[model samples]
Target: MRLLGIVGWTFCAALLAACGGNGDKVNTPGPVTPGQSSASISSNTAVSSLSRSSNNSSLSSGAMVMTCASVEGAVFIDETCPNWQEPSVFEQQKVNSNIYYEVPFGSDGALVSQKIIDSGDALYKKVWDIQYNNNNDFNGLPHFRAAAAFPAGVDMSAYATGKLIFDIKVLASPEANPDFTVHIECGWPCYSTDVRIPIDELNTWKTYELSVADLIRDGLKITNVAMGFQIIPRWGQQTNTHFQIDNIRWVKGSAPVTTKKCFAQHFDRTDWSYTTKVETVDQMPLDSSKWLAGVGPLVTLIPQWNSVGAAWGFSVRDTETLSSCAAKGTLSVSVLLPSAYVDDGQMQLGFYFISRSGLYYILDGIPASRLKADEWNTISTTIPAGKISNAEYMGVYFDSKGSNVANGYILLDNFVITHSLVQ
Candidate 1:
């Protein structure tokens, strides 16, 4: 049912990790708190947890223990990984924040585009021209943000402990003493800092580092950011200052498990029209008028379990795959039951992994009693490994007992998919 009629027609490429604002509010449909989606880790680890307590909104990692295999749902999403998990630690995250592009770019396979925000009168260009003979040994080269490239509210707090690493070069523009200031932010309040580049430094290519911890030194929380990153150049006005930034990224300590999440559905949208049921990103039947900024494919599931046999299942996409994502498994959901339904007792929510071999590995049943009455509640569980060592797909499947005779149906949203980016 494409219920939401056409509202408007404006669209942007749909890449969630670096998405400016698709208006897609991803939720955790499991029994855990909303937004607590992380890879399954050992409770005994020095760091008990690494999660965003966004008040069901979205927060950041607190100072966690140093030793670990990997953080599931790490800050950096492998632009290419189907399951959204990074197989390895991103020592350097190339700064290509404006991923509003026609196609994907970078080794991470992230979306690449010219620019999302207008640079105003300032002239600019994306170039491989001036490595300008930079002195620093660049990790990844070729692409750089040149001229007045100012990407706004970028999310880098995930690498808060890491250093802000990059290299800069100047083209010796007519604008005398042309220079720019790079602004980086931390936390929801947007605690930020700006570093100025002098004319002398502009002449040659050089590497620079800004301590992520130092920027938030006033005891600021970087785990979650209010505004991610911004770079504003102030030189001879109208006089386009020519400079290029190469290898802009964060240098992190270690690799952790990651789970990139995309909203399949969020019935919570009140103001506009919404497509209630969609199985994949392409199926999102949104009122494009309101979503003038195009929407990604909608993730949907069939609540019916009778003839279908499968209650909820999602076919992987080119952007998503059953690739290297399986080391740590995750299942999450948000559900609401009415008073009368609670009167009848609980319903069981089962999570499963259907491997390429057609084998099924089901987690324990989650009792609906764990859900709140009339209020959306989240529940999550760690999928046991081995059984899913060769997972081809994953989803939730429940007996029709709840859909058939139960006083109410199980509401699912913010479907969380997981897999190891690393084999």
Candidate 2:
């Protein structure tokens, strides 16, 4: 699922523009007559079309712009973008290898030391030294994070059957077993599962290798690798920690195959429930409990329409945790619309998942053509590879075009999610 903030903002903007109003102000449309043409009704509440693409030229005006100063074949680094800062003295210079050092950041008063120093060994010339104090009062404790980014991204499809290799040493720590995590990121909200690193012996260099296939199974997009990896110290540990890292590279190798296990929800049970947030005529109150029901072994949703042609259907919740396995799969649902519900071209239907932190992951809505009148139609959206384990609620939503018709409802069922797993 894509970030909902951008889509929600665009949707609201189109609604306001169609209503001929300014920011935060909505203009109520006049009532429609029986003889009015469908085109006339659409003119009052038409929603503009928006698209997103990976090519820089296809990006919308609202998309974040990144300035890449490095060449395509070289390591990616940018100092001009608003989201990036200039490299500090502690950051290591780019070498011929895949690893490009990045400056580390941490909570206030938590960062104790960060530097690149020459290694005494003959093979490894330089290494990174990172130290932090996690006992600070901020949030009861502080945290530290360092990242390796590929601003222009690299197509690692050629290394599909390879391995990510690195070397590390735990120099000093409060606990005998120091622990940290490495997260391979594709982009914002797109990350592999936490690859934990635990050190049992201190001051001893060790080499570690992880399969590329395992990372891919855990939701890492190999084609467009926005960030190679990120290192984050575990939380709630009030102690000082120090570690050194070197020789981060990707090597060609053979990896074991993996399979996937899927789970689905039919929405045929009678105990299902829904919550409604809709606009009705005269802003009249609505009975949330009466908006949804199980009929004919299928779930049905009823919407409350407002005078200005704005309406929202019921949001049905899934009782199980299917969002956790949404990557490398599709989130789909079946819907049936009545013929009386005129197609205004602006109607949109889709699914959404909300995280525990209240962040919304919403798929772009399917067009009106995908919804068949008087017949069941399957609408699906690809769930992008990302971190969605915190998703607490998954539901369906529908936004109607500015139609003045009343007594409109829809039938929904067969919500499903399928994904891959490492055996």
Candidate 3:
């Protein structure tokens, strides 16, 4: 049987709700404290001990905040996806310093139009254009207004070692035609764009941590750093579509990650599904072989899984087909998990992958410090070939944990596995 109804919705909705705010209160369904496991690594380590302190800080809500931005005029919603059917439009209330942009649509796929918050509004929304049918399935190109510059100049060079903190609400478009990366123009006006990071899913609001140093190494400059959206078309065609947007911010002087491209990948366009029971596990194998959990639970057929109180993911297991010590196979997956449930003892979420190298581990555990209780978060990791084993098959996993009874939930999508240089 499927885990259905309002309880399931409350769980998932509460989780997504936890991703924003002024970094004040913890918003999940539980108290503020650490949860289940402690041990963690960068996918470069083994499952040695489960007791060691993992970098739970990565899950906490600290420096991330969305102060209220002024807005004026009519913010309307329209039909921009494949079918020009109008989806439900809800309230655009500015809550707790963060703008909550809500759209009510059924499981059936429908593109929610862009809400225009006047140019003179604190954000000057016009700088960020919501273009349709540009070149991809449900495409949107957000151009920053010259006025939207950093109080401190945007240095593409500094991003290599600075911090990238911003929140985005997106719905998975399709598998092979997934939402593209968040590009920034680094030079003057910072107009030269590159996909430094992609918004791997649909139907959820995800807050991302972008490493400034890593951005520079990836060919982005530090001057005039600007963020925008770009989506590709699917079904062997291109079309313009509308997606939602709200609470976008960038914190200055943030930390950066190491610069290195370590994975080869393939294109995907599958949507997301939702669930709240053991049977939900049956839906997310990489492939039909069952050896690999393709994508399930919270993944919609048309790929929209952004409903409230729901969590989704993908997984894969490996066989003895790779070298045991090669140190560099290919691991390419992009994931976004809303941090809304980090403080909810009733909620636990994570991703797991087993390699053919006879090695296996998980990317999740109980909540810790890095992830806050009610905010959206973006996480990316690579699975090296040799990191597992020379086994023939490998498996991948994505799970959002909670009390069997349920309280809070998660929204997730965009399962990608690519080749990278790892050891």
TM per candidate comes to 0.32, 0.38, 0.32
Per-residue CA lDDT of candidate 3, range 187-269, in tens? 33222222233445554444455444333322233454433222222223223433444433343443333223321111111
lDDT per residue for candidate 1 within 1-423, as digits (tens), equals: 011111112222111112111222333222111111112212211100111101110111211221112433222211111122221111222344332222213233121112112212122122222212221211221222211223223344456445555445565554566545544433222333234434454445555554453343212234434333334444113123345443344555343423333322323333111322122111222232221221122222323323311233232211134323444554454434465444545334444444444444445544444444544344455544444455444454343233443323443433443333345
lDDT of each: 0.33, 0.44, 0.29
How good is model 2 by TM-score?
A: 0.38
Task: Order the numbered candidates by lDDT, best leading.
Answer: 2, 1, 3
**Candidate 2: pairs in clash:** none
The TM-score obtained by model 1 is 0.32
| Residue 28 in model 1: lDDT | 23
Poorest lDDT segment (10 consecutive residues) of candidate 2: 14-23
RMSD of every candidate to native, in Å, equals 19.6, 20.9, 17.3
Better of 1 and 2 by TM-score: 2
TM-score computed on alpha carbons, candidate 3: 0.32
Error of 2 at 28 (Å): 32
